[model samples]
Structure formats: C-alpha cells, structure tokens
Target: MAGSTFVIAGQNAIRRFKPKDHIFETLATHVDQEMLNKPNDLAFDALGNLVFTCPGNSRQEPTGYICALQPDGRVTKIPEHMYFPNGLAFAPFEDALIIAETYRHRLWKGHWNASALKWEDAHPWVEVGGPIGPDGMAFDQAGNLYVAIFDQAQIKQINPQGEIREVYPLSGRRPTNCAFDLSGKHGLIVTEAERGEILSLSVDQPGFPLFRGNNGWK
Candidate 1:
C-alpha cells in the first residue's frame, strides 16, 4: 500500500480510491494533454512517483510506452517503441526500475536519475522466454525476483545476479501477479487468470518490504 489511497491503472486512466471518502478520483486520463493508449501496470519509485506501463492496442507492433504521475498532479511519459510493456517495479537496491516487455519475453532493468526524476540507462537484463508473458513480479529480501509467468503455469525465481534460480509450477494455468504477506508468514500470494484462483507458495525468505510512499500522491 503506497500512501493512503488505493491507486488503480486501466481503462485508459489512472484512478485513486480514497477509503475514507469511498470515492474514486481520476489521477490521469491523458498524459501531456493526450489520451493514454492503455495504462497496464503501475509502481512507485524510491521518491514515490507513480510509474506505469501503457501498451495501448498495438500488441503486434512496437508502440508501447511508460508514464509517471508526479506528486503535484503531473503526468509525464517515457516514450519507447517496444513490443508490449506489461508490468514494472522499482528495484529494492541500486535505485533501478525493472519492466516486463511481454511480447518480447524480456525484462529491462534500468537505473534512474533521482534529481531529474527519469530513467537513465535501461537495457535487457534477462529473458523469460516461453509464452511471451511475464506479468507481475516481486523481490525477496534475499534478492530473488519471483515472476508469475502468464502462460507457463509457473513462477520463476530470478536471482540477484540475473539468473533463473528456480521454477515453481502452479495448479492454475495463467498466473498474473504476486506479492508477499507483509508478516512473511503467508509466503507469496499469487493471483491467476485461467482458473480465477489465488495461490500461495512457500519460499526461502520473506519479500523486501514494499514502500508506503507519499511521493506521487502527496
């Protein structure tokens, strides 16, 4: 939970739900005064700026992009021509951001410029080759990344050195996203699409604590 508001991304807009008021407020519809093609997934930087992937409708073409919502209510886009940018997360170490390009079956990890509030140098860090759908991911305290493979019916653990450490097969076919129980007792709580189920897997260590940021939604 980043900040007090529940942030949602989809339907060409980024909305926030304030539990206290029980209302959904639109944070961004059009970035830079233009309609968002299709906002897919979102995450927060070390500074709390809201970042998301927008693949639009061009799944077969390289037209996907990324955007960020500033704390002061501003939206900025990081333009790129990639297959399909699906999910993203801020690296717990090295002030980096890792993004999933689903169609290409690749993950790009890049360092960011804190002062400029932008990505500096990002390149292909690893390949999740199989069905071309690396959906959601999270990092453990031991520096392993658990990625829910969309069509592979499994979860992969990527080590800190950017290698496939292990693979945990799932009963559900299409695992979409995952997160760890804050208390580290429930292991990894994963959501799936094919069977519409929530699965939990025991692991070696607890996940790195997620940030409750006040940067973007300040």
Candidate 2:
C-alpha cells in the first residue's frame, strides 16, 4: 500500500492500483450493501487500515455511517450514525479522526482507539456558516484543517480551535476535494470537478506529510 494508489468509485467499490506493473485489483465491491448506499471518501489509519464515509441518499439520514476496511479484507461499520458523512481525515499529530457532515454543514471529531481498533468519543467539532457544502478535507502541519466548500467555489481553513480562520475563493469552479502536494512546497491542490481540472494554490504553511506514523510502512 505504501507504493500503491487506492481509489473509490461511485459504483460503491474500492480498487487498488499498482504503479509498478500498472495492474488494477479490486479491493472491495458492492460495499454499499455491506455499509451504506454511497461511499464518499476514504483515508488510511496509522496501521494502514482503510477508513471511509458513506453518506446514503445524500440527505440528513441516520443511514450514513463510517466504516473501516481491515488489512485482512474485513469490513467493519463504526458504531456512530451520521447525517451525510462526507470527507474525512486523520489529525496531523493527534489520535483523532475528523469527518464532515455535508447535509448538516458541520464537522465532527472522533478519537481513534488503536487497542480496540475503532473510533470513540465522537462529538461536533465545528459548525460552518452559510449554505455551502463541505466535502473533502486535509490537515496542515500546524493542526489546521482545509475543507473544500462544495458548490461555493471556495475552501475554508479551520484552525485547531474549530474556528474559521480564512476562506479562499477558487476561480468560480465547484471544488469537490483538496489535498496538499507531497512535494514539500506547501502547494494546495484542489479538484475543480465542474471543469474537470486540478487547481493548485500556494500556501505559507506546509502540510503534514501523510503516512508518517511510526507504524507506517517503510
């Protein structure tokens, strides 16, 4: 997984691709039936376990859930029921996982219990204003969060205190997801889904390099 690329499809499937041989392998399919109707976004834990969000029907329903895909191919649905859970990310230097509830315009945090292999102590972290939809999210080295405001053509930066610090406008394009480049140049890359293009923005703060945990694969 350290050298592979993982992708999630709208058809309710997750695939793993090997860059070396250009081989594509099915990691999970028909996962909707096993979890929820839609699998939105995913992130890997410190131990390489896949954590994903399922926002069923794109509404504020209890049908939404957070799920985990273990290394052994086992799927586990987390015990919390959410309303349209969307983008999620692991905290930069904390034992926490943050998730966005698109329909509610809020962000929630959950403590990761490594010994139990689950997330616990779930609570609301932030309440975003306006009618903008919160989608994909990423964390910076300073523990700040950058969330893509879907349908609003902007990205909002939330500090560790869960307060909106800055709102950056994207060139009139609907952004669906965002992440910091791995080049250590502190450039933020956003997906302009409406135009089928990727936009990059220069930032003063560098992002936390993902997969840097002690348990991460070398």
Candidate 3:
C-alpha cells in the first residue's frame, strides 16, 4: 500500500486513494458522522490492524478518538479522550500501544484486549518538558524510547529504566515523527511545521548530516 495515498477527512470525503495515477476514490463521504472529521496519523499494529487518529472538533467536543478500521470497512473506537493523539507505535516487542499526546507533551500507554474492543491499563509513559510538543516516537532494541520533540528542535531518548537520557539536537526546529533504520543504529526524522523536510542521523553522531530531504530519510 506504499503507492496508495489517502487524503483523510477531505472536503470531498474520500477514504482511499491510489497514487499510481493520483486518483482519489471516495470511500466514505461524511464518513465520520460522530466528529468534526479531521484525520491525523495512521499506523498498523502487529496484527495488521489499520489504526488511525482523528483529533476532531478540538478538545471541547467529545469526538476525537483512537479508531481501528477493520478489514470489513467497519470503524471502531479503541479509546476515548486521547486529546489530539499524534504518533503511535507498538512498543519494542510488546503488544502494548504507545501514544504521543501532542498537546499534552505526554506519552500514554495502554493494552488492547480484543474481547473488550477498548483499551485498558491506561497510564502515563513519559512527560517531557514545558510545551516540548512531543510527536512521532520509536523504540530501539535496547528498549530506549525516542520521541521527536516538536518545538524543541531535538529528540529525547528515554531509556528502558524510565530515564530521559539525552536530548539530541536537530537542524530542524519542528520534528514531527521518527523511525529507526533497519540497522537500528540510525534514525529517520521528519519535520511537519517547517516545509515538511526529513533528516537522517546516527545514534552516535547525533548532529551532522547523514542525509536531508526525502532522500536522506529512507
């Protein structure tokens, strides 16, 4: 599905799009009847469940939620009160879900039990400094949690022991997401607020240019 591109909650209300010809097919118009319907990030779980975040109607309206779009085109809410949940990932080697609360600068973790269709074991994973504006997150093999601090122009590494190890500075000011390379020694970072550029850096050489633009991130 790499070639497939979907514009979420657009004016036309399309759900799926194929990029081969840049064709957007409307799968659900007014699909999100419950919320304001602005879609956010999407990621797949280990079981290939297509999970998505939509911080609809601000924090005032009771619309934003973490939802999973089933294979049969059914949408179900997993958890409520996510508060502009931005980034997510299945923890290092566990089934637990790690969510980045964008506005709260906090990390929330929970477990998904299929029978319940709702998340439980909710708790704070980590909370960064004032308005660090946390975003995309990833985990290293060593169990170190790496968070892209949006406004801080840095990446904060949280070790397995719950220690905030080091703040690695970045050339870009607003890093929105991050992912480790296949080798696990480097990272691919993306900035959203600034031109939507990407950067690649090593775990050791935290500061220099390993790559830039889209070419560097992959």
How well is each residue in 107-184 modelled by candidate 3, as lDDT tens digits? 888886544456679788788764656787777666677888888888888776667998888877888888766554
* Local accuracy by lDDT, each model: 0.82, 0.79, 0.64
lDDT, candidate 2, 116-192, per-residue tens = 66788888889875375789988888998999988888889999888899999898557889899878663899998
Model 3 reaches what TM-score against the true structure?
0.75
TM-score of candidate 2 to 2 decimals: 0.89
For model 1, the run of ten residues with the poorest summed lDDT = 1-10
TM-score, every prediction: 0.93, 0.89, 0.75
**TM-score winner, 1 or 3:** 1
lDDT of 1 by residue, 19-113 (tens): 76677888888977889888888887777778888888657999899988777778888857977888787777778888899888888988876
Better of 1 and 2 by TM-score: 1
Which candidate ranks first by TM-score, i.e. highest?
1
- lDDT computed for candidate 2: 0.79
- Clashes by residue pair, model 3: none
Error of 1 at 201 (Å): 1.0
lDDT score, candidate 2, position 162: 85
Model 3 spans with C-alpha error above 4 angstroms: 1-9, 12-22, 25-32, 57-63, 114-116, 181-186, 204-218
